[model samples]
Target: MRLVRGALRAWRDSFDCGGRSVAMWFPGHMAKGLRQMKGKLQKVDCLVEVHDARIPFSGRNPVFQEALGVRPHLLLLNKMDLADLKEKSRILEQLKQEGLKNVIFTDCEREENIKEVVPLITELVSSNQRYQRAENVEYCIMVIGVPNVGKSSLINALRRLHLKKGKASQVGGEPGITKAVLTKIQVSERPVMYLIDTPGVLSPRIGSVETGLKLALCGTIRDYLVGEDVMADYLLYNLNKHQLFKYVERYGLDAPCDDIESVLKRVALKLGKTRKVKVLTGTGDVNVIAPDYNAAGYEFVRTFRKGELGKVMLD
Candidate 1:
């Protein structure tokens, strides 16, 4: 983690979208999932909105607030292990000002802070008179979030903690792993609680190109949709801005670099990520070996996601 102290070169103040559209990334399935979730609001007792802790401010689908704001809402910022939450109090304060009073940081894979989820939901639901279904003793809460924010992992964690059961929802690293709203899966036996798991959905239009890039970096949006080269460049700019120089040692670089091309070239050569390319010569057509920039970009993004480069707050 060596830091180069000198006159630093200027990085990109803002990213250009290059006339790229985010509409293509918002598929038809996400729209259908939103509709289905809205239709199930009558039976829902609470709304558990999950999101990546690294991106707490950006990439949340505003449609959830507009359509499902009637119920008691709790925001679960998952993947705390990968986020740098030194300013957690400030983040919470900002969220509270935005009308989100309930927020919890959790890591579902390690089951960290898993016990607090049910109790918090119980308190919120009991305090609200709207959910007073006198005839029913069971609690039905709907879990919603954008794609690839560990919504399914949270459900499985609760089930394992309370019921000693296996997974009921499919888990994956990519976005849109769960395609549709699933049936209510019972997670607790004491208060008779059942959770409805919904597929991850994104807004039809993102707030801006920067927000979209943040979403892509956090795996909310697919890498191919945003282009790996562009995402890698943004990631480099962010790491340099935050002074997270761990990538330098991890990739065997002597000092911090401001250029993505040089960084990717070194990464490709070190990892042996190369491909054969056809070349035109005076002698005849020839094939030459060249560094695979795409492969290097993919690896760079992967390392950041896995926390190898160090924890960061991308918001």
Candidate 2:
């Protein structure tokens, strides 16, 4: 799709979160899951943190890092297919400065770079003296990440690639799919490897609204928690900032848009998602067709999640 050539318009430099907080999305299950994960960490060999590649620098649950940082760690930035990774080296350099030397960019949907997982785990485990003393040949690994960042998808992909097995850990689009620490699922047979899939955990105190919005945009948090309208607005801001205008073609807009309500209204009408609402007038209340902004917002968000709107890096 060709983006229309139009005069550059001034877009909002930043998004106003309207005094919102990320405290709303921290459910009881998340805290329970974190405690449960620590209990089983005694038997774990490697801790793999699967996070969204789009926001490599944001929304990672610091609690996980603090509690489970003792083990040999691997940072697997999943969902690379949906991210615009124009400068991966820069991202790597930043992570390296932050003392993260083991990081892999992956697309669990297509199982890209999945084969590297088991080997890397093997190397990390072998190098670490703590886990290397194990008597059994079978290696038990643990998977951790914030919600909806493809933890289950990565496990399923590894199983598919290594063991030719199906998804033992259930997968879902919404957050908190795996509410508790799951039993070990086998993904390899040669060296006898197993993976313990844990619930995706978010930072108890989300740093700021911008960080929350980025996580919400990546579907790490629920839409209603962040107000779909504003989430869509922030998304629009990000799309324009990144110069990713695929939404223009997707929504049949004549040009790029800054107003999220207009874009969502267009999406609602285009998708035939209008609803009839009663309006009070001088005469009486009359039914009028109105665009379903919630539905449109959902569709717009889902479209971006599916990578139809374009590759975006929301960090």
Give the candidate number with the greatest lDDT. Answer: 1
Model 2, position 79: C-alpha lDDT score: 93
lDDT for residue 106 in candidate 2, whole number 0-100: 98
Q: What's model 2's TM-score?
A: 0.94
Question: Considering only N, C-alpha and C atoms within 3 Å, which residue pairs clash in candidate 2?
Answer: none
**Tens-digit per-residue lDDT, 158-269, candidate 1:** 9999999999999999999999999999999878899999999998788887788899999999887778998999899889888788988888887888889999988998
lDDT (CA) per prediction? 0.90, 0.89
On residues 1-315, what C-alpha lDDT tens digit does candidate 2 reach at each position?
665475458777888788877656778988999999999999988899999999999988889878988998999999999999998999999999988999999999888899899999988998897754665588889999999999999889989998888878899988889998989999998778999988888887888988988999999998777778788888899988887888888788988888898899889989998999999999999999999998998889888889998998887
Q: Which stretches of candidate 1 lie over 4 Å from their true place?
A: 1-13, 16-20, 133-136, 283-287
Q: How many angstroms is residue 252 displaced in model 1 relative to the true structure, after the best TM-score fit?
A: 1.6
Assess the local accuracy of residue 160 in candidate 2 as a C-alpha lDDT between 0 and 100. Answer: 93
TM-score each candidate.
0.93, 0.94
